[model samples]
Target: MNAHPQPAEDGANAEHATPSGPPPARLLRLPEVINRVGLRRSAIYQRMSEGRFPKSRSLGPKCTVWVEEEIDAWIRGIADRGG
Candidate 1:
């Protein structure tokens, strides 16, 4: 049972790859954001509303994602600020 995660079928997570190959990258989804920042959904949104956390990209009415570099920088800043 090779149960590897199937490639994103047709939604926002679908591979943006051309007929050539996989897309250059993937936008980080909410679960990934929570894992990386160690923040709950509400906290993340609150901080975002207060301009404390990096805002996410709105892919569509139901799709929101973050840029990996932005999240990494925010984490770096947290460490630099002695958090």
Candidate 2:
């Protein structure tokens, strides 16, 4: 070990440094999306089937996530339309 020890990393943002401009959008798990939009699992699936919600992306054989920006856009649209 070096004589000078580096400070402990801030766990809150240990993944990456703060970004300039708009922060990069990340993939959100189903529960994360539900929590953000306050929708039930079945409702999200129903809306997606009706082509009114963002589609989930397959990450692997059994994993999927939604683009956070897409969900945010959906919410913004609802607000814009006074709904």
Which candidate should be chosen as best, given lDDT against the real structure?
2
Candidate 2: residue pairs that collide: none
TM-score of candidate 2 versus the correct structure, residues matched by position = 0.71
Task: Give the per-residue lDDT digits (tens) of candidate 2, residues 1-83.
Answer: 76644443654443455655887779999999999999999999999999999999999988989999999999999999999
After the best TM-score superposition of candidate 1, give how far the Cα of residue 34 lies from its true spot, in angstroms.
Answer: 0.1
Best by TM-score: 2
Model 1 clash pairs?
A: none
